[model samples]
Structures are given as structure tokens and as C-alpha cells.
Target: MAKLLMDLTPLSYSPALRRIWLGGIFSTVGYSITGVAISLEIYALTSSAAAVGAVGLVALVPLVLGGLYGGVIADTYDRRKVALAATLSMWVLTALMAAHSWLNIHSVWVLYALIAAESLFQPINQAARGAIIPRLVKPRLLPAANTLMMSVGTLGMSLGPILGGVLVATLGYQLTYSINVLAMTVGIWALYRLPAMKPEGTAEQPRRGGLSSIAEGLRFVRGNQVVGMSFLVDLLGMFFAQARPIIPALAALSFGGGEIGAGFLLAAGPIGALTGIAFSGFLKDLSRQGRFLTLSYAGWGLGFTAFGLIAWVFDGQGQGASVRESLLRLSLAGLALAFMGWADALGGVYRSTIIQTAAPDHIRGRMQGLFIITVVGGPQLGTAGVGFAAEAMGAPLTAVMGGALVIITIALATVRVPALWRYVPEPVPDTRQIPSV
Candidate 1:
């Protein structure tokens, strides 16, 4: 209804954005490679959804813990150092994972421990990444920047599973994990090239208590209804509807075999997301971003419902449908997930824009830190929830239930927090002054 796209006349580009974007591309590829390898490795060894779920839970503590302290550190110290340290720590974890796999030490406990430690550091890196964006790109170009980031990430997501599948199926887990370690080292080198980013205002006096620092961030978000609602919607949608953690189990029982099938199925959503981001250049003039955010949540809910229904179709196709059927069904599910991904990208763009425009510079790092927590925590929560449900009710029901929850929660949000639909930022003029991708 709105014009499908506006002309790209006013957009400008940046060296800072390009460097950061390239670094993000490399980091994401490394992250995606490791994600697929580790997930497949654990599933291959234990073959239990609950055991797989343990990985999510193990990461949960450290992820949240890191986010809490990471925010404090981001605000109190040089953000570049905090991010670099966390990035280096993840490289170490990848090296440990490589060593463990190569030595034939297949202990699930050790894998969990190493992954949890890595997960903890991950959020610190994430917080820094979030804080860095405002500095690299101008406000008017934020949506385009988010789209670019998503596009690059989608590229990584597309490659991770495909490459991880090839490596795991042909070369084994050791080689797959080793590749991630090497990739992460490259990411570290890129990270080292980044300039230091200090907090925007006079450094807040070093706070003594962790809880106090964290509470300050909470207070900032809570006082702003728009930012608060945006986070709530994202948390509710993702925590309920994200279905990746259970994909391996679904592949084994409902589809066929493991590893390869699982990897393909897992790669579907992000590939779809990649497609959405690629065309997002068209959405530069879109308005009513709050409404877009709500609709995107609704769309994600509907996509989840479609995912559940398609499983039935895939199941009914019988054995003859194996190759063609899997591809078709996976494509449909991927399309559905891609829609969800688009919604997420739109919401993310709007949310980031709102936070940047509204929040004071002094507290931006702390604010972004809490935002990182929400973003990371949601999927982890979804993973654990879906994992448990898959173990109890099986994959289809888990999908259905999660879908239903997302829809229901969003419906409630639409009515109860009616302000979310009304929230909109002042429109930026297309001007030579604004920075571009």
C-alpha cells in the first residue's frame, strides 16, 4: 500500500560502516559455522532433544551473566577493549572445541562446559556490536544498515549449514570445528582493526554494585513505553516461535537420518532471511514502523502455524516424497521462516532507530547492553522451550503450540498495549546530510 520503495537518491556511504560491516560479515560466518558444527556434533553423539536442550540452558547462564556485566563494562570501560576481549575469548573456546574433537574426547559434559563458557563471552561481544552501530552509520541510514547486516548474516547462515554439512559428513567433526577456530581467528584480526569507542558522555563514576548498574538500564527502558514494548514483543515472539533447536530431532524421527537433513532444515530460515534482507533496499521509505513491528510479529506467528501444518503435509507425502518432498517442504518452511525473519529485521530496524533517537548518549551503551540481553535471551529461551516440548509432545505439537502462543501473545499486545501500534518516530528527510550504506 505504501509505495513499494522510494528512490535511493539521498543515501550516502561510509568507510567506518564498510569496515564494521566487513568485520561483521566475517564474524557472522565464523559464528554460523561453529553453530552448525557444534549442534550436529552434540546431536550425533547423544541423540536426545533434552541433551541438546542442555546446550541452550548451559549457554543461558553465561549469556545472561555476560550481558549483565557486559553492559556495565561497556559503559564503564572502553567498549572496543571489552568487545575485543570477548571476541578473543570465543576464539579460545573454539580452539578448545577443536582440540577436544581431534583428540577423540567426545564427552558431552566437556562440550557443554566449553560451549557455556563461550556463550558467556558471546553476549559481551554482542553488546559491543550493538553499541558500535550508531557510531558507524547515520540515523537516516539505520534501516539500510540493519538490512545490510542481516544480508551479510544471512550469507553466513546460508553457508554455515551447507559447509558444515559437507565438512561433518565428509571430513568429520574435528575438521569442522577446526575450521571455525581458524575463521574466528580471522574475525579477531578484523576486530583488532576497529577503533576504540568511549561512552558518549562524561564517564559515569565507576559504580560499586553490579545490581545498581543493571537496574539503571532497566529503569531507562521501563520509563520508555515504546522501547519497552518493542523489546517485549520481540521477546514474546522469538521465545515462543523460534523452532531451530528442535530441528535435529524432527529430522531424525519425522524426516530421516540426522546431521545432513538437520543442517539443511536448520539453514532454511536464515537463507530465507537472507533473501528478505537482499531486497530490503526497497523498504527505505516505509513509515509506521511501529505498526510494521506489530504486523511482523503477527506474521511470524502465522509463519509458525504454517511451519506446523507443513510438517503434516511432509509426513503425509510418504517415502516417495523423500528427495523432492524434503526439498519442497523445507522450502515452504523456509519461506515461512523468511517472512518471520523479515518481520524481525523490520522490528529491529525500528527498535534500533527508536533507541538511538530517544535515549541519551551517556546511557546508550547500558541501554544497548540490556537490548543485547533481550535479543540473545529470547532465542535461548525458545530453544529450551521447544526442546522440552519436542521431548514431551514431539516436533509437530511443539511447533503448533509455539505458534499459538506467539499469535495469542501478540493479540493481547495489540489490545493491551495499544500504544505500540501508535508509536512512530519523526520522519527523517531524504537529504545529503544523512549517511548511507
Candidate 2:
């Protein structure tokens, strides 16, 4: 019975992790809300899916640079300091975003610049924290630890949009952006309490990271099939079928709810993900993570395929949708997204665990940086590509086409890399070494 639920052991075991996990809930919500708000804001401002999709294009270069450079920064210096500085910077930028609306100085170019800058710092923070976690918790509890983190992130995904939708609908963009500024303090405080997280072996061979360091990291990934495939598979999933850019259009033209409908569509995947992670105790000791990850890819493809078909069939202009009819249409789409999120939960956890566990600690930060790129940056790029796609082909056909590609790509990859499902993590014993300030 207990194994059927999320393992609470990680929360119980580590004080530092516990504090961050708790605070992260709020900050993650803040981040999640702001993402949706930006999309809606762009769509409202320009009414162009291309403009909305451009958000991803603006963010892509920064994300790639950040992933490459951020990994080096995390590996070379004190990770805690890096995460702290980046978090504070992110807070300030988000505050500026609030000002852009409140001060009535609205420009998509300015928004693009701000988002691009924010994208840079975000990955630096992610790389630092991703590398630091293995130091905070016992090595054995790594899977559980990641599950807990995923829970918080997924929770933010679930709640942020609903709240963002309601607030954006009722309050307008000015106030909607301010909430993130306040919510992030909790996470900043969490980082403040964390121990100094220096990567292992830094004392004896401490050095700065450069292009050479990045190349070395890339080499490692190229050689490690499991970790390499994890990144590849995730990129394919997000790049082909990521549905965010077209969501507003889907709401207005297909699903019929406007801002509220858009919000429901945005939040659906996270809600599904949260439900899966909340009850993920059964996955605690499962060794067949690779097998399940492959299965997850299949399910992810199917969910998006299903979602696209529903939108195509029930295409409705936003004007005349009865409240009940709108609700029904949105529910169907959301349900499919939920199923995708459920399937993604399995893949997300397994892939993350595999990456964190399989990589040597020395290069863990670098690997995690790449992981963050795939998980976050890939979606950003996809949003841009598919945003334009939605504009050209309409949301329904674009989604259907993208989902089909995902299914095909993974099937071929699996056949080529037969050992992906055969991989298992190399264990490290518990070492309670939390570096202090």
C-alpha cells in the first residue's frame, strides 16, 4: 500500500532538501504562471501565432549557450553561489516583466529581450542545482529525491495555469506578473539555507571551464549511449509534439474558451503529470526503467495524436461556444494532454534518474546542463517551430503531424540502440557530505 504512493523518505531524510522542496512549490508555481501569462500576453498583443512562436526562437540561443556554459560554471565553481545569483537575477527580470505591463510600456521586442535574458540565467541555476542534489541526499535515495523534485515541478505546472488563467482573465496582465516576484522569495530563501555545493575533486584540480571543457563534456555524452539516448529521445518528444505555441489558437479557434480555455489546455499536461508522480511509489526500486521509458515515448506520441484529432474534429470558433459545449471540448483535449503527461511522468523520472545516476559525479553538472536543455530548451525551440507551424497548417494538423513524427523517430532509434532498455544505474553509497558556507 505504501509503495503505491510517492515515497516520503527523501523528504523525511534530508533537512536541506526538505526546505528546498517545500519552497520550490511556490517558486515553481511562480515560474509556471509567468510562462503561460507571457504566451497569452503575446497572443493578445499580436494575434499572430508566429509572434507567439517567436518566443521560443528568441530563447533558443540563450538556452543552448546557458546549457553549455552553465554546465561549466556549475562544475568549476561553488554551485550554491551560482544558483543564488541566477535566482535573484531571475526574480529581478520577472519584476521587470511586471513593470512592462504595469507601466503601460508594452512591446513584444522588449518582452523577447527579457525572456532571452531570463533563459540564460535559468539554465545556470538549473545546472548548479541538478549537480548539487547528488551531494545533498544519499546516493541510494536519488530516484526518490528526483521524484520529489518532479512532484513540486509538476504541481506548479498543474496549478500555475489554472491560477494564471483565472487571474489573467479577471485582473489583466499587470497584476498577473507581480505574483511571481513575491512567490520567488521562498525559493531564494531556500537557496540561502543550502550548503556550499562544490563539485567533487575541485580542491585538487580546481580550474575554470572553457570551450575545451565543454568539448570534453560533449565527448563524454557522445560515448555514453544511455545518457546520450536519453537526451535525444527527450528532444524528439518535445521538438516534434510540444503543444504550447498553438494552445491559444486552439482555445480561440478549436477548443473555444479564450483565456480560460487556453489556461485549461496549458494546465492539463501538468495535472496529468502531477497525478502520476504523486502515486509513483511503485517505481521506487524498479530496474526496468529503460523498458518503461520506451513505453512512455509510445504513450506520449499517442496522447498528442489523440489531442490533435479531437481538436480537428471539434473545431469551434470562440464566439458561439455554449458554456457547456466549450467545457466539453476543452475537457476532451485536456484529457488527452493529461494522458500524455501521465506517460511523460514515467519517462521524465526514469530518464532523469538514469542521467543523474549513470554519469560520473565529476561531469554530472555538464550532463545535467544538457538534460535541462532537452527538458526545457527543447520545448522552447519546439514552441517556436510549431507556433509558425500552427499558423501555417493550423493547430490541429500541425499537432497530428508532429505526434506522428515522434512515434516514428523513437521506433527507429530504439532499433538502432538496442541497449537503451538494457541499461541500469551504477550505485554509489551514501555520503552525507553537504558542503557548508
Number of the top candidate by lDDT? 2
Q: How far is candidate 2 from the true structure (C-alpha RMSD, Å)?
A: 2.7
User: Model 2: which ten-residue window has the lowest total lDDT?
Assistant: 428-437
lDDT of each residue in 1-437, candidate 1, tens digit only: 22333222222466655666666676677778778877777777888787776677778888888888887777777778888899988888888988999899998899989988988888788777667666666666666666666566777887788778767888998888888777776667766777888866545466556788888888877887777888888888888887677776666555543566667777777776665655565566666777887777777777887777767566534233343546656667667666666666655656666666556555667777777677878788788887877789777777877888998987898788776788756665654232210
TM-score of each: 0.90, 0.96
Candidate 1: which stretches are off by over 4 Å? 1-12, 203-209, 316-325, 428-437
Q: How close is candidate 1 to the true structure, as a TM-score?
A: 0.90
The C-alpha RMSD in Å for every predicted model, in order, reads 3.5, 2.7
Task: For residue 97, give model 1's deviation from the true position in Å.
Answer: 0.9
Q: Clashing residue pairs in candidate 2, if any?
A: none
lDDT of each: 0.72, 0.86
Clashes of each: 1, 0
* Candidate 2 lDDT, 293-372, residue by residue in tens: 88797789889989999989987655556446698888889999999999998678888778877666667788888888
